[model samples]
Target: MHDDGHGPGPARRQDQGAARHEHGHSHHRAHSPSHEGARAAGRLRHRLAHLLTPHSHESADRLDPALEASARGLRALWVSLAVLGATAAVQAVVVVLSGSVALLGDTVHNTADALTAVPLGIAFLLGRRAANRRFTYGYGRAEDLAGLAIVLTIGASAAFAGWTAFERLLSPRPVEHVPAVAVAALVGFAGNEWVARYRIRVGRSIGSAALVADGLHARTDGFTSLAVLAGAGGSALGWQAADPVVGLAITAAIALMLRDAAREVLRRVMDAVDPALVDRAERALSAVEGVHGVGELRLRWIGHRLRAEVAVVVDGEATVRQAHAIAVDAEHALLHAVPRLTAALVHADPAPVAGQADPHLALAHHARV
Candidate 1:
């Protein structure tokens, strides 16, 4: 072979030098305008990701809305118990002095109402316990049980109020110091109304129907207390029958409250969640980028928290990965759409064509907190 001017070593070194030069050129090309534009897009996507997702640091105390609601509910219970205790104490003193059956009945109910908070507070605390193997949904149903207990208590109160008032009406007795009874009645009204408004406001804000019902009970009790004041006024005007008559009226009022509380308790027990929440979930699923339809959306309350099961329809041409992404989007949207929703399970299916059976039709859809 003829000797070339460049030996084997020189040729190998030259090849290496050319490869290094080409690599440098390619690296430099990576920073060109188009490449920088792609980098900018990558950076924008990363930033958008941060904005779209929740931050761990935002929950510094790790207190979510449901947890905060439970905490606030406990606080409200304690405060109302204190207020009603004070009110009932004053009324009990008046009851002893004046021997007014109406005031005594009111005092009893106010005390019972205050005590009802105990079961509810216990329920709220129980609801905080994590789910177990036997109770996959946790102890939230305890709230419904607490609600039932409250209904029973109120019913018993009404029966007692009615019986006592009827007995008093049968045997007339003069109520002494009518003015003291009236003052106690007024105190009862003020305290109960305050508690009612506080509980209702807080309960509604926290999406706690049980608490709202309890608040309504307090409101009804306030009106009954007002009836007691009317009785005192009637007794002062020499209409002795007015005291028993007012007590009977309070019993009737309490009957009405019992009906309301019973209905609320029954609804919760039957898993009759608000229809508006269902509508909101459907709307959110429909709005997702690849979701073409929403079907079989179910929502329910376990304790105070909400849970949803939603079926979403995506394009038939979508790959499994694409369908998964759509389902995830639907899940996220549903969570934000419904208040107090703690969990959501989204099922994605292909959009059905004409004469084609829907894929999600036969699937089991169930929701529980």
Candidate 2:
């Protein structure tokens, strides 16, 4: 009895073997071509990564040049202040001998500028120190504070000088030793110009806001010295009133500079990154091939460099591993584009599609609904 229910026949066995062979062939045909292509692409990517990875470290090392430039600017400030202090003392004696209120007030302003330099030098030194627990962002802001202090001091000096000049304008006074004052003003102008050039070069090279502020102050002083020379020349020619008039002009110029300095310091303290800079950052992130969109871009100034955080959307069809790799590549591209970026945090989001129920799109609809 061929248990009519189930019995293996030669024909049935041959049919099963043919079915197994067809199934295996279909599986090989489905995966083989794509697998080879993927493998080849991966090998190319590995070679590229090896070549590009070292460049990131090299770019990081370039930051040292900026730090060194800042250091040089600080040293220049100290030296310039020392020389100005000595000149102030000499001018004080000359002003006292001449009994010229304009000369005396200018000398006083120089002395105040000299005093500001002392604290600024200290702040620069401290700012360069390694970060401690007390200051997670480091002492870099000390330089900003020093800049504010210097501007305030200069502003106050300018106000006082203006007041003194006004009094002299109301009642003109005879000035003696006009030749000596003129000579001194010329020397001071030359000295200030020298320091201003040095500070500007270093500040721009390092992107140090404090150094730039100091350089501006020096340049203002150089212009004031020119005003002083004109006053001395007028006094020698018996135009005693020119001393106060030139003093008033110098005070006006100083006030303008103080306004600008205050604006810059406040911007830094408030972490206000320029809109242009933000746009640049967005462009840099979007340049990455796999990044579909960018959002929640935020940036803040950390001393000379910028700290940024952004959200990037990538192809939703990609595997989890691919999304992660794309995110890393986007980050690398951003750093390369903006060399001054100190740190960046990137969030990877899945891209949205027309018919699919994307979580991000759903959340947006819910908010609108």
* lDDT, each prediction: 0.80, 0.70
Cα TM-score per model? 0.82, 0.77
Candidate 2 lDDT over 1-369, as tens digits, reads: 011112245356334423421211111212246744774686598569879865433322544644665577677778878877887878788877786666666677678766777767777677666555677656667777887787788888988989988998999987888888887677667766777787777766766676677778777777888888889889988997988888888888788878877787778778887798788878988877667899788887656556677888866555444555566566666666775665566667766668856555446756753
Query: What are the runs in model 1 whose C-alpha is more than 4 Å off?
Result: 1-63, 353-369
RMSD of 2: 15.6
**Candidate 1 residue 32 C-alpha distance from true site, Å:** 28
lDDT at position 171, candidate 1: 97
